[model samples]
Target: MMKNRRFSIFIVIILCMVSFSDLKAQAPANDKASVKTFVQHFYDWYNVLQADDDFTRKHHLSPFAFAIKERGNYFDKPLRQAISDYFHKPLKSGETGLDFDPIAAAQDTRSGFQTGNVKQVGNTFRINLHDLPKGKSEKEILAAETFLVVVAVKVGKDWKLANFIYPAKGNMSQTDLIKLLAHQKKFGY
Candidate 1:
């Protein structure tokens, strides 16, 4: 039984990989552009959170909503405002701030999805993130490691970060949660 379950997971991952491979060829340029766009959009929305009337509207965050918890800080906010605030603030070069560099990114055609895996031993850290010097020790690996999955439907020529969340696993990771909330925006579920 255990072997079966593991096999099932393996199959799922294989399928996901196959999906990504197909996209790799056709999507090399297209998906790469989307991935780059998502990063720049997210970076500006987060690291360069300076108030800009142009970006404020360009972000189209008013329609989106995002919420994720880190340490004790609740990361949920109106999509536009949340990303706006993120870009509005300035972070020091090596500081453990909201914005962190992505180690690698891939575009999956089968799923029409763009995903990126952030390494665990990179310049930034996202451990429990409260105690700092002491807190840094525990989740040192987890801190720097997280994943961002994005869903985009082409608009004109560029792809925008419709919605994104952190490393995935259970509810704690919050990717599915964001998707759920994204769906319930109108009905108020």
Candidate 2:
């Protein structure tokens, strides 16, 4: 009877270990889903900016300032400030500006659907968005455009957007763009 009880206890321990390992294995998948959702929300916000009037656009983008102010790192503060100024100030006629494009950035080159993968680099994750193919549904097209890359850093268990790069002129990463922006004192100190 004693032997049987010990064996039963051992089996239960082994089963618990296996279950925990399985949960651990699923963690990556959950993380990916979360990252994808974050990007999608950003895309949705960008779309609203594109469609809305200047006054409405500023109101829409104002919330992101809170996110940047609250969670952004040292480098991200200037970027956030620049974004805030852009929306708050009046637009100049025929002035071209940079913004995240969801369609061109997230579309799969072959599939014409939004597709991307998260690559872990040190403590950061680089989300590389693919280009959509020639033909696709309007809904899919509206879902994403010109957003090329997004950099995320893990804060506790949650991933926060550190920076994002748009494929304008050429493929420029956020790190590169921020470096350039830092030099321009007009944007922020």
Q: After superposing candidate 2, which stretches have Cα over 4 Å from the reference?
A: 1-29, 54-115, 130-147, 167-175, 186-189
TM-score of each: 0.31, 0.45
Model 1 agreement with the true structure over 63-87: per-residue lDDT tens digits: 1222121111212234444444444
Q: Write candidate 2's Cα lDDT for 9-41 as tens digits.
A: 999999999998876544364666677667656
RMSD of each candidate?
16.3, 11.0
lDDT per model, in order?
A: 0.36, 0.52
Name the regions of candidate 1 deviating beyond 4 angstroms.
Answer: 1-25, 50-143, 169-174, 182-189
